[model samples]
Every structure is written in structure tokens, then in C-alpha cells.
Target: MARASVSPAPPRVSAPDLPRHLKRVEPARGADLLQATLHLSGDVDLAHSSLEQCLLTADAERVDLTGATVLDVAAKDLRIASMSLRNAGIRRLRITGGRIGTLDLSGSRLDELEIRDVRIDYLTFGGAKGSDILIADSTIRTLDLPQAEITRMAFVACRSDEVDPRGLRAKDVDLRGLDAEMFTDANGLRGTTLTTFQIQKLAPAIAAGLGIQIKD
Candidate 1:
């Protein structure tokens, strides 16, 4: 997947602490959007398309962008039942204020992405590769990351009922602000950042993984 020569690559996100509430410059309210392509303005089936520097806001039951190469896009207030970006290459994308039943990014390559204020029932990154991704101020019912290689990802002020992290290859994945009920593979959390309080809260489960029993 290739990005346009006009759009520069985002800087690398370092370890330990991640920037909070980072945002791009949004277009002025009611400004002429003729320059910016309004994707999903007409067709919903945009599979295998190369969409660049677009703006979209919609309410749909299902929207598919499978195998698409999306770059430098800003979307807001998207209410969808299911949104799929499977096997796609997405870069420098921002999404806010959305409610989705399911968001599938499995087997995709996501870079420099930010998703905030969205409530997703199921969000999956299975078998995907990602970097510099942030999901803040979101409520997700399930976050599936199995077999995913992710770098510099953070979940700030987010809550998830379940996070399946089996076979996860991660670096600097901050979970300090995430309140997750379960992690299917506790050991898959290695090389990720977690606050002391979070680790203490999961002490029992961690001990159980090591076959250590604590008597009450």
C-alpha cells in the first residue's frame, strides 16, 4: 500500500507516556468542502479504492471499505451497525463521536490513527499491524487483538468488558486509563505499560496464571 507524496509520514510515538487528546486541524464549520472529497457522499461500496484527504459523516447500518487505502481522512458522528476496514491500509485518520455495533479492522495496517468518543460493541485488530494508534474516551464492549503486532498504542479513558490479547506483539501499549474486565492471555501483555493500581487489581488473575493460590 502506498501513500500519496503530498502527505508526510507521522512521527514515531515513543514509549512510557503518550500524548493526550491529540487532534488534527479540522476544517472550519461550513467551509467549502469542494476541495476535500466527501467520501460516502454517494456510494457505500468503495472497496479497493484509494481515498485520500476526504471528509465523511454519516449514519448507516453497514459501511464497507474493505481493501481500501485511506489516507488523511477526518470523520465524525458516524453511527453504524457494522463498519469494516478489513485488509485495508489506513493512515492519519481520526474518528469521533460514533456509535458502532462492530468495527472490524482485522488484517489491516493502521498508522497514525485516533478514535475517540465512540462506543463500539466489538472492535477487533486480529492479525493486523498498527503503529501510533490511540483510542481515547471510548466505551468498547470487546477489544480483540489476537495475533496483532502493534506499536505505541494507547487506550486512554476507555473501558472494555473484554480484551482478548492472545498472541499479541506489542510495544509501548499504554493501558493506564483503560478499565478492562478481562484479558484472555495475561502473558500477552508483556512489554506494555500498565499503572501499579491496574496491576494490583489484576494480581489475583496474574497469580492464578502462575498456578499460585492465595487463601482468603
Candidate 2:
């Protein structure tokens, strides 16, 4: 007997729409914006700008904030192709939901970086220094944190396809609710805290790394 043909999966849905009637502001150096809604279309260069409780709708292809300072900012509901924060300082950087292609924070300093409910294609924190970093309720395709100096790193209810934490030096690493397909160079997380369930899930990988055979 011949079997029936299966239908193909549907295409992925696009991100949500951005807010309308966002006030346009001239990109200036050291500008302080509070509770403002700004929109960007082309490449944005915000050097030394302070954003407090502001909503940024990034429709731009690239956002370059080299040598800038961002605080208490929330970015959501937009599609940014690329974001670069080289040599910038960020505190309380909360990104709730959005679709970001790539984020490069090389040589930057961050106090608190919180990312929740977002989808990122690629993210790199190489040569970056941060204190508290939390990634909760997000889906990341690839995350690279090589040579990062993070004090506290927590991954709560996050899923990642690939996480490369090689050369990462963190004081406290907590992996409470993380479901990763592949953790490259997992030895970087030697001092991390994992629950019994997480350990059970990673038993095969741990055993392979330690050259221990599991017999039935």
C-alpha cells in the first residue's frame, strides 16, 4: 500500500509592527532623552547619548553606538539588521522582544544586560566586560562570549542552538532553566551551578567529555 504525502511546514512569521507616529530626533552627541519614542530608518550613530525609560523602534539596517552611554532603555518590536556597541557603556539595558540579526559588543562595558523574550540570530560579547548578565525567555541561534569578564551570568528559561562560552571568566554562573542543543567548549562553565534535572539532561555530554562509558 502507498502512503499519503505530507504537507510542508508554513513559512516563519515576521516580527510585530512598530509603534506609529514616533517623534523624529536629530542624532546628537550626549543627548539626554527620557520617556521618548524615537524611530530610526538608516544607520544610527548615537555617541554618548543617555536614554532613560525610552522606547526605541529600530527599523534601521545598522545601529552604531560607539563611545555612547545607554541607561534604562527598552528596545522592542522592531527588526535591526546589525547593532554595534564597541567601546560603549550600557547599564540596565533591557531588550524585551524583537528580532535582531546580529549584535556585536566587543570592547564594551556593561553593568546589567537583560534580554528577555527576544530572538537573535547571532550575538557576540568578545572582549566585553559586564557585571550582571541575564538571558531569560529568549531564543538565540548562536551566542559567543569569548574572553568576556562577566561577574554573574544567569540563563533562565532560555533556549539556544549553539553557545560558545570559551575563555569566559565569570565569578558566578547559574544555568537554572537553559535548554541548549550544543554547548561548545563547555569546560568554560566548570564552576557553574546546574540542577539535578539539568545534569541528567546533559549526562551524555558530560560522560563523553569525561570519557566515562554508560553501560546498560
Best by lDDT: 1
List runs of model 1 lying over 4 Å from the truth: 1-43
> What tens digits encode model 2's per-residue C-alpha lDDT throughout 1-216?
898642221112122233444455666557877656777668887766776656677778988777777766667766799987787888777777888899888789987788878888998888899877788788889988888877677777888888787888866667666787877875666656767876777787778779999999
Tell me each candidate's RMSD, in Å, in order. Answer: 9.5, 11.9
lDDT of 2 at 42: 84
TM-score of each: 0.81, 0.76
As a TM-score, model 2 comes out at 0.76
**C-alpha positional error of residue 186 in candidate 1 after TM-score superposition, expressed in Å:** 0.8
User: Poorest 10 consecutive residues of model 1 by lDDT?
Assistant: 26-35
Give the whole-model CA lDDT for all candidates, comma-separated. 0.77, 0.74
lDDT of 2 at 59: 77
